[model samples]
Target: MTSRVPRRLYLTIVAGALIMSVAMGIRQSFGLVLGPGAVEWGLSLSTLALAIALHNLVWGLAQPVAGAMADRYGATPVVLVGAIALAAGLALTALLPGLWAAMLGTGVLVGIGLSCTTFGTVLTAVGRAASPERRTAMMGLASAIGSIGSATVVPLSQFMIEADGVATAVTNLAMAMLVAAPLAFAFLATDREATQAPATLTRQLSLGEALKEAAGHRGYILLTLGFFTCGFQLAFFAVHFPSYLVTCHLPVSVGAAALAVYGASNTFGSWFCGQLGTWYRPQYVLAWIYIVRGLAIVALVFLPKTELVALGFAGVLGLLGLGTVPLTSGLIARIFGTGNLGMLFGLCFLNHQIGSFMGAWAGGWLFERTGSFDPIWLATAAAGGIAALLHFPIRDEPVARPALA
Candidate 1:
C-alpha cells in the first residue's frame, strides 16, 4: 500500500513555492534597474554596484539571525515581514530620487525582506514537515517555483522598463507583492501539533560554537566552499551579462532572454536535481555539478564571442546554475538534523552572499578599470574549478549532541 502525503505537508510546500516565486522575482529584477537608474541619476556603475553589493552582504549576514529567529519563533511572522518589506522597498524606490534612499529601499530593506521570506525560511518550514525521503523533492519544488518567478518576471520587467518608465515599472512590481503576501497565511496555517513541537532553537548554539562544529565537519565545509563558487558565478553573470552583451554589440534584450532562460531551466533543473539527491550522495552530485559548471565556463570563455554563443552559454549555464540548490540544501539536511537547519543553512547562505558581493563588485571593477570583462570570466572559471575540488574532501556526518550553555 502506498503512503499518502499529509495535508499539512502539501499545503506548506505549495504555499511556500508561490510566495517564494513572487519575492525572488522582485529581488532578481534589480539588475534591470541598474542601467535606467544610472542613466536617470547620472550615477557611476560602482555606486549602484556598491549598493547591490551591500544588498547581498546584508542579505547574507542577516540570514543566520533570521533563521535563528524563525527557529526560535516561527517562519510565518518572518515571511510576513519579508513580504511587507519587499513591497515597501520597491514602492520607496519608485518615489525616492536620492541614492541613499534607493539604497535604503532596495539594498537594505529588500535584502532583509528576502532574508526572511526566501528559501532560507521557506525551506526550513518545508524540511521540518517533510519526511526524509521527501525533503529533496520539497527543496527542489521551492527552488523551481522561486525560479519560475524569475522566468516570468525578468522579461516582464524588461518590457515594462522599455514601455513604461522605470519608476512605474517598479511601482507595478511592488504592487505585484500583493499577490505574494496572502500566501503567507498558508505558511501560518500549520497544524498546532507540528508548530508546538520543539525546534533546535530552544537552546540554539552560539555562532562561535556552530562555527566550530561546521569547521570540523567535512561535509559542511565542502558544502560551504562549493556554495561560494555558486554565488560568484551567479552574481557576476546576473549583474554583468547585460553590459557584456552591450559591449559585444548585442541588444540588451538578449541579456534579458538569457537570464530568463536560466530562470526557466533552473525551474526544471532544481526539481530534477532534487530527485537526484534523493537517489545519490548529494555531496558527490554537488561536486560534479560544480565541476561541470567550471568546464562550461572554460568553454564559454574560449568560444567565439558572439550573441549566439553568449545566449547559448547563458541558457546552458543557467540550467546547470541553480541545479545545485536542491543538492546543497538536501545534503545539509542529510548530515545535520533539522533542529537547527535554518541557522546552519543560513550560515552556508552567508558564504553565498560573500561570493555574491565579490561577483557584483568585481564585474564592475574589472570593466571600469580594464574596459573588458574577459578577466572576470576567466577568474570565475578558475574559482569554479577550485570549488569543485573543495567538495571532494567533505565528510558527511551528523554533529554530536553536546551539553553546553
Candidate 2:
C-alpha cells in the first residue's frame, strides 16, 4: 500500500513531518525552562505563566490569518516567515532581560511563528497532496514522524539546560530552527500543484461564504468546542508538568525522562489514531482518546508519585498526545473538503488555543493561590469528559453544498 504512493507525495509528507518535528519539539520543551527562568529573572510563576498564556492566545488569534494566507497563496512563504519568527523569538527570549522580553518574544513572536508553521499549514499541504482515501492515513504518517521532534528535542533541551543554562539551551533551539528553515521550500512545488487541482467543493466559495457555511454547521461547532479541551490539556501539560514533577521532589531527570517517553509514545499514538480514523468514525475515536486521557490524568494525580509511576503516566499521555490533531483535521476535511481546509481547521484551532491560554494561565494562578495543582487537575479532567460528550454525537457526514449556479 505504501509503495503505491507517489514519490512527490512522499516528499511532501516527509517535509511536513520534519517541519512539525522541529516546531513542535521545541515548543513542547519550553516547560523545562520554567524553573530556571523564574529563578534567573526573579519572576513569579504567574508572570511566566501569563507569557505562555499569551503565546497560546496569540497563536490562536493569528492562526486564522495564517491559514487564510496559506489558502490564498501557498504554505511555503508562510512557513518560511514562521521559521524566521520562531528563531527570532527564541533568540529574544534567551538574550533579553525582564518581563517585557518574555512577553514579546515567547508570547507574541513565537505564537505568530507557530501559527504559520504548525498543524494547520503543514497538515493542509499534506492533506491536499493526497487523494481523499489516503489523506487521513498520510496525515497520520506525517504526525507520527513529526513526533520524533518532541521525543528527541525534549531530552536534548533538558541536557542542555542542565549543562549550560536556559539561555544556552534556548539559543541552540533557535539555531536548530534556522537549520530546519530550508525544509519550507519542499512545500513549494507540492502546495502549488495541490492548489491547482480541482477543488472538492461544488464550486469555490468566497471566504465569507466558507465562514458562513462553517458557522451554520452544528458538527463543526461541536468539534471546535471539543478541541478546546485538547489545547487546554496539552498546553497545561507541556508548560507545567515538569514543574509539577519537581514540586513533588522528584529528580529533574525524571521529569525529562517522562517527557521524552511522552514524545516517543506519541509517535505510535498519532499514527495509530490516524489509521484508526480511516477504519472507524474519527469523532468516536477522538472521544475515546479524551476519555482515556482524562482517566490517565486522574490516575496520575491521585496515585503514588514514583519514578515508575510518573514514567507510566507520561507514556499514557504520550500515546494520547497530538493524536487528536489527525483526527480533528481529518474530520474537518471529511465534512467541508480540503479546498478551505487550512482556514476551516484554523478556525477550530482558534478555540483550541483559547483553551490553551486558559489552561496555562489557570494552572499557574491556581497553583500560586492554593499552593496545589489539585484543583486544576480536576478541572482539566472534567473538561476532557465534557469534550468527549461533545464529540460523541457529531455528524461526520459531508455537508450539503449548493450546486454552482
Candidate 3:
C-alpha cells in the first residue's frame, strides 16, 4: 500500500490544515478578550472563566460523537455544520449582552463547533487519507501550520479589540470563520469510502471493538492520564496568563505581545516535533517535552517579572504549546490502527479537555478566593512532572496488521 501521495491529496491536506488553523487560532485568542470582555459586559472574571471552562468541557464531551459521526458518515458534512455553528456563536457573543446568552454562544456553540472542526474530525480525515508511513508527518505539518493563525491572529485580535472594541473584534473573527465552509469541500469522500470496502483491513474492526481494544491497553490509559497535563497547563495560560501579567503590573500590551510570541514560537516547536516524530520513538520525545515544560514553568514562577522575562516565559510556552500533539496523536494511530482514528483520538483529547475545564475554571476560582495565581502555577508544575512519568511505560509497539486483516 506504500505509494506516493497524489498532488490533489497534498492540496487537500493543506486546505484541511488551514481549516484547523482558523478554528484553533481564533479560540486561542479568547483569552485576549476575556479581561476586556468582562469589564465591558459587566461580568466578573470568574463568570467569564466558567464560560470558557464550560466550553472546554463541552468540546471534550462532543469530540467522540463528532469523531464517530465522521467515521460513519464523512468529514465534509461535520465540518460544514461546525463552521456554521462557530460563525453563529461568534455573532451571538458579539451581539448579545446577557451572561448566559454569551455562555450559550461562546461556551456551547463554539465548543460543539470545535469538536467537529479541530483534531477529532479533520486530523482523522487526513490520517485515513495518508499512507501509514506518512500519517504522522502529515499530521505534524497540518497541526504545525495551524499555529500560524495564532501567531498572526492573537496580536491582530488585540489590535482590533483596541480599535473597534470587543464586539467588533469578535464579529470580525466570526466572518473569517465562514471561510471554512468552502474549504470543507476539500475533504473528498474517497478515503472514507475506501475504508468502507469489504475486503480492506480498515473494514475489519467495528467502532465498539476498536474502542474496547484501546481501553484494554495499559499504554492507552497512561497516555490519557498524561494528556491531562497538556490541557491543564495550556488552559491555565490560555485563560489566565494575561491577567496574571496584569497583576504583575505589566502593561496590557505586554500580555498581547507575549501571546503573539507564544504563537510564533509554537510554530517551530510544532514543526520540530512533527519531524522528530517521524524518526524517533514519540514516547521519549513526548516525555522530554513534558519534563522541559515543567522546568520552564519553574523558571517562570521563580524568576522576577519584567517585560523581557514575561516575553521569555511566553516564548518558552510557545515552543512547547502544541509540540506534544503530533507525538500523542501519531502514537494513537500506531497503536490502534487508522480505521477508527477519529473516535479513538477523540477519546484521548477528551481527557485533555477535562483537564482544560479544571485549569480554566480553577484559575479564576482560586484567584477570586486567594487573590493570587501562585497556587495555580504550582499545581501546573506538579502536573507536568506527573505527565512526564506517565509516558515512560506506554507500550509503543504497533498493533498487528494481521489481527485486523
* The candidate that achieves the highest lDDT relative to the unseen native structure: 2
- Per-residue lDDT for 1-405 in model 2, tens only? 567457768898898899989999888887888778777767777898898889899999999899989988889999999989988988998898579999999999999999998999999989988888888888998999999999999999988988998889989999998888889888887667656746443877778999999999999999999999999999898888888888888988888888889899999999999999999999999999999989989998899888999899889998998889989999999998887899999999999999999989998988888988878888889989999999999998888887765
Q: Which scores higher on lDDT, 1 or 3?
A: 3
lDDT of each: 0.79, 0.89, 0.85
> Could you tally the backbone clashes for each prediction?
2, 0, 0
- Which 10 residues in a row give candidate 3 its minimum summed lDDT? 1-10
Model 2 residue 191 lDDT score = 69
Decide which is better by TM-score, 1 or 2. 2
How many backbone overlaps does candidate 1 show?
A: 2
- Report the Cα lDDT for residue 5, model 2: 54
Q: Could you give candidate 1's per-residue lDDT for residues 1-405 as a string of tens digits?
A: 124347777788888888888877776777777888777656787788877777788889988888877766778888888778878877786788568867888778878888888878888888877888889888887787778988998889889999987888888888888667777666664424334654543354555666676778877876886788898888888888888888888888888888888788889888888888888778777778878887888887787778788877877776777778667777787776666678888999999989998999889888999999889888888888888788877766656665434
Q: What clash pairs does model 3 have?
A: none
In order of TM-score, best first, we have 2, 3, 1
Off by over 4 Å in 2: 1-5, 197-201
Query: What's each prediction's TM-score?
Result: 0.92, 0.97, 0.96
Model 2 residue 334 lDDT?
Answer: 97
